[model samples]
Target: MYVIYLRKSRKDSDLEALGIDVLKRHEETLLELARARSLPIGAIYREVVSGDSIDARPEMVRLLSEVESGIWEGVLVMEVERLARGDTIDQGRVQRAFFYSNTLIVTPGKTYNPAIENDNEYFEFSLFMSRREYATIKRRMQAGRIRSVKDGYYVGNIAPYGWRRVKADDCKHFTLVPDEKENPVLKLMYDFMGNKKYGFQKTCSALTGMGIVSRSGKPFNPATVKTIISNPVNIGMLRWNYRKSQKAIVNGKIATSRPKADDYILAKGKHPGCISEDLYYRANSVNSSMTAPVKRSCRIQNPFAGIVRCSCCGRVMVRKKMSAKQPRDYLICQYAGCATVAIELDELENAVLEWIRNYIADYKVNNFESADDSEQESLRSILVNLEKEKETTLKQRGSLFDLLEQGIYTKEIFFERSTALEDKIKDFDKKIESVNADIVRLDLSKKNRSTFVPKCQELLNAWDTFDAADKNTALKNVIERIDFTKTEKNARGQRHSSFSIDVFPRISR
Candidate 1:
């Protein structure tokens, strides 16, 4: 008995001709073909959506599981991709599922038998072409999104909560605008977090107490609450790739670095904001501490208090006690004959603060280049060229394969040439990936350097006068450690002192 299968992709081209009705037509045609060949038909398996991913369509999944149970003699389909659209990985799954159950896959164009030697190459080539098509589709989709963003349209799945799409004044397009009724929740959240000085959990509880639900109108989980607070769109700006997985597309089936920050289009006042920029920034500063509530409530102590080392291994000395009656703690470095000696924590803190202040002052007066727009543009150009080169190499590889298959070259020559081509392709692919990674890193560095560097300097300059909590936060943000080492030396020997700093803003705090 044969099982007729069908699938439609997300593309309008696929949907227009091969939607539900078209699948029904294919079913009718399969029945006619079956009758003409005197083949017994048992059941039909149909998927209304694309099979770019195996898990995307439930019907296809059910069919594959049933096929593996040896419930069908064959899977008849209109085309190979209809059974498994877009990629070899997906097609391989369907091929294996049917083959393991001793079933054949019969397409209108080609009937593939897994056991045949010559047929293996054909199936492999077909699957490879499917994957290539998938990649092409992904490139096109990304390019479209880039263009759409440039055109200033919100190109996401759904508008943020408390916002609704409405026709722009031009009437040619739609824009997101604040929903009058729903926006109140945003204001409330901002007030609780900012003015009320409530912790995240407290704010969540307060919302629930007030009978207020999340954007989804359900109990708010910590993740959801965090996401709401962190989303820049609510504060009249938009940031992409905040959730890394959102950058992936099913057609590619691989994680890729999202578009750079420079690519994000900003439309100011395009929609009424739920919270002001100052309030949002203030809220972020208030929530900067990553400590849990339990730690905040308890008397927190660090076991590795002074064990951490700095660039110089001078033993971190501490003052034993203030006096005969009072207890005191002070960090110092005691390296004999070394210029470094036991200095009061207060004194050392003052020195570090002076050094940081001088550093910032020098940095400012030197007219240091923060980030130039032209640099971002240049990086984008480099990435675009690399992508173009990758595409060209893929097409050339395809042509070489065609030539090999057409007997334009002998097997020995074809094998040697193809091997070299594959090596070149792999090298180019690696280079492309490397370039993309560099671009992502550069973008992130530029963003952080611009937004946080000034803040860093400001905190450092005020470190000496900062409150205990602020001092701790500043120290945690900047210094990795202050090490101390001791050494025996001749009496009254002169000493040299040296220290180094490695600033890693991203990973430090």
Candidate 2:
């Protein structure tokens, strides 16, 4: 009994471009060899993908597992090297698989019998040579990539946001072109972070408030906001080997990871920059200097943790618990050199309720529409367009691999196109999701309109009985933030003082 194992090699890519079916050719040759010797072919394993290790390649793993069972008399391949060219351990594993099974390694050139000492030694030597060749090819590719980066070409698999990857008209290399729609948003992201001195969270929130969304049509997140503002690519720069790939054995399986590295090649790119270098540097400085988020506590302390801010310094007002002598909780601005005076929490809460009542009056006067049939109809129209976009993106994605195989796109270009298409498809899906959510929210808003005033009144009535966390959550559901201004602190500790409170409601009214 015998079996055939097949996998495409690196050289096979070029052959594929030449319209040669390398696998089929190998298969025919091997089949001819089998017929000449009158050997019976029991099974055939064809690997449709490429991977660096056995675990990464499914068919190869199954072949080795079966070979280890010693069920076959021989394992036929186009070349002995095709069986294993991963690493020394992998080659040794392949060597041992045949040696222990006493199976012959069959190729078109010659047959290697594991039982013979000379044949086994020769087979191992062939596998080692194949590994060396593979390593050399990879090293060359890496060197080429680095050279491309140094020459101001964009060799990355995906283009940075606000930019599109395009092959340079005058040269063989690829470069970045600004995306009209995304370019403005990318610039605004920088403006928010650098010029306005907003943190990632605030920048994302501001963008969402302005109805700016990612290609996926979802609200921008902190991580995405940071990536966009901090990326030197927006300033016409390229980063090479920023995070180098690290390979290790994890739980008896090969795993690859790329960890953040401080040292990397940062060169000026050929692409036109979207933002100024000053903006780029400033945003990064703010990003690094910002404090980390506080972890959630077991018990809630402040009802207005996020919703209250110091009007002077623009920092979130912190809850300061008084000692036994003071007997009060004050929301204080913690910024150094800030002139903002702290106000007692009791006084602030009462002011917030008064403001809520005023807001209810204003809402009624304005006669704002909570749910509109026309708005839902508009959302439905947007949803249909998003679905169409997703369908087109998916279709483009389907042909990307074929283009790569046909040599229509280089490996780098293929990756960029694939990533862009995938991102577009994901964005469309999210946009569709967001539209659906809007429709549902409109339906909920109809029910919610009558409940709003009662909800606020109930909270005001039950303020003392409610838990700190419960109060905070209730306030956050309606209020965006409460700006507090107090320039002069009272010489005498007064619960009631000349302090001002400005409540920013989440609702439009």
Candidate 3:
């Protein structure tokens, strides 16, 4: 018995445009060929997915498995390319599976018996030709896509949240037009995060509460909100080739890493921007300031959720409520083997507040002697030095251009020197900004601290009124980590514990 294996080419856009009927015709043609050859077709394995790799197509994998078991005497296909159009490794696997099973590969034009050396040679040669053709077609398609992107047309299928995909005038390329229904929601999201200082989770909750669903008709998720906010496409910028390399099939799916800043292809898009560049960056900066694990939605407003670590096992301490009727929250070590005893959440909060108050008292006493004017003068001197270095780099870059024009430097050398100078200028620019920020902070410190202590005290006093996200942010800004360990019980059986808190003051930028 013979199995008829059929596959539609992934790169065949013409066949896809003609619709499913064209693929059906391919099946009919293969059936006709089998009947003419007088072969008993046991089962027909038809795959609509692109036959790029053996792992990518499930039907193909099943076919190979049955063929290797010696269940079928031969395999019938339209062509050898239908069996494999992948790299040498996949092609070799297909060839060896047939050869070891002593199966015959029957195509329309000829019959290839893998047991025969000559036929096996012809089959291998056909696979090689198919691989070469696949490479050629892949290159042409990639070149077309690059050209399409450079021409300011949207090359991807799915448009971003605020945009709708539309066919261009030429009917060959696509463009993005603003989706009327979603644009208003997108604008509101940006305003909430950038202008209102709302976190991603809070903003997502607000949108979902307002009955704003995503394209899938599901409630907005934090990941979806983050993707929309951080996307440069909203600012009328197209970013392509952001992956460092081509995707590799890992666990039967495409996986790739982000490319470096220099490798990205960024261009001004033809579509109108939904948010200003300033708003985009500001929202992204706020999102970036958050700790990694804090991006999710938290049900309980525990400021010390991720910050509190188990002293014994170094695992994060989780907040567990004892009962629904008389709820008493306690911070317990998440690890099963950790011997750390549970501490009441209220007791922990009180300890943290006391530490903050003591820190403020110490700051007020020690900071009085250090004059802010002297610090400002020092920062100003550093800023002046950075400005001079920036000027020198700019002059060096200007000289390189002149040297290139005067034939004093080759194109390669000029580019090398220019890149070095450009990098130097960027470094100087960052240092200058840092110094200026320090100067501003120094000037503000003198006046702000007079009211800072009172404001902090008020924040701590009303901490319960703040939401979970706000409390988390405030704790992260103030405290680095709080170590807790239980002490031995006294003769009266009274247990006592020691708390060590590491405090980091919030720096204004």
Candidate 4:
């Protein structure tokens, strides 16, 4: 009995040559060939796979197993190349298997009867041809992909939802443009991401509630949604040299690593986008800022996410839930080897409140009547110097022009001297405008400072009524990074809370 076999390569050109149901057709051809040779065909086995690697082919293994069972005395294929490319190693394995099973391998052009010595060389030649064909097909497909990319065609499948792929004028190349109707989603997504209050899940829920389906009208997936939010292509750029692949080097050469942000190929937008450049930038800033938070299994909001840091280990201290059964949570140091014990959330809250109260009182004590006296003086000095320079430069320019008009100097000489003085005057005018703006700011600052103190005192008085989250926000608004360091006792000493705080008034968290 004879078994029919069929195999097709997944290469691009083969995709065109073999048609869609190439494997099925090849199996049919094998059956017909078996019938023509008056062979009794038992089973038809078909294989559809990429021919890039031959380490694991399930159909190939099944064929060998069937031969070993002695149910089929021979196998018939449409062509010899269908077995495999003429690779010596692969052919050797196939030859050995057939020899052990005493099975005959027949193709349209030639037959491999292990019983005949001369048929062995012909079988080997068939394997070599298949391998050569595979290499040729692969090379051509790769070259086409390179040419397409160079011509700015978007080659990947489906093209990430919000984008629509359209072929170029030539009909051979493709490009991506933002889908007009779906582009509004980008702006809405950015708005949600820019604020820390709305997280990934919340954003998705909000969008779903707004009757905003995905580009395909399906429920929004968190993974796919997150990818769309973070993709650089939204900012009118394509990524090249993005994915890392394993490759061998002949010499002592190092693998070049491309920087993700810098590796994107910037392209002009071919379609209208809903989000502006500024908003896109802000969204990216928000996305990149909190990478560590999203990876955590537990979702406890960290009060001092980017602010608090351990002095010894230099890791951010995160809030940890101590007991799920009780309302007992604590702030724990994030450092892996840190010996610091977790401070109870309630205790830490009280400490922060007390510290803030003390901080406000201390700030009030240092707040003299002329709180910004030095800044005011510096502003006045700068304004006066600028006014004097402007006056001098204008007077010099006026005198030079007068000399030029009076015919006291040649046109060339006059232009040379006048150009030099006019340049200086322009420079001075810019400095004057800058100084005038500073003077106005100083005036505004002086006026605001008087009202600011009372407003700050009012907020502090009401701080006791504020929630933990609100209090954290208020404190961060006033202070930048607080250095929590161990306070050591000196010769005449007093011990502090083991940690000292460094506060900045205007800097951000």
Candidate 3 per-residue lDDT, tens place, 1-509, comes to 99888777755567778675655777788789888888888998888776467988998899999989999999988889889988898899899999999999987789999989999999999999999999998899888877777777888878988989998878878888889998899999889888988887678668877878889886675667888887788988787776546566789766754544576677777777878989888887664312234333645457677788777767677766556653667776543234576776777778878877786787777774276777787788888888887888888888887899999999999988888888888888888888888887777776666556666777687787887567777777555677777533224434344545444445321
TM-score: the better of candidates 2 and 3: 3
Q: Pick the candidate with the highest TM-score.
A: 3
Better of 3 and 4 by lDDT: 3
lDDT agreement of model 1 with the native: 0.61
**Stretches > 4 Å off in candidate 3:** 244-262, 288-509
Model 1: how far residue 111 lies from native, Å:
3.9
lDDT of 4 by residue, 1-509 (tens): 88888776554355665466776666777767777889987777777664433345677778877777777899887766666663466667677777778888887776788877778777766677777777787679767865666555666667755678887667776778777776678668878876454555556667777878776665564545567776656766555445534434437432443333535344444334445666666655653211245233643355555566666666666666444553666565533234454454555555555665675576578764355677667877887887888788778777876887798888898788879988887887888788678767766766655555555566578777876566666666655665444424223333222444455444211
**Best candidate, lDDT:** 2
Predicted structure 2, TM vs. truth:
0.54
Off by over 4 Å in 1: 13-39, 48-52, 55-58, 65-69, 85-90, 97-102, 113-120, 166-174, 246-272, 288-509
lDDT of each: 0.61, 0.82, 0.77, 0.64
| Residue 506 displacement in candidate 4 (angstroms) | 58
Minimum summed lDDT over a 10-residue window in model 1 is located at 332-341
TM-score of each: 0.48, 0.54, 0.57, 0.47
- Is 1 or 2 the stronger prediction by TM-score? 2
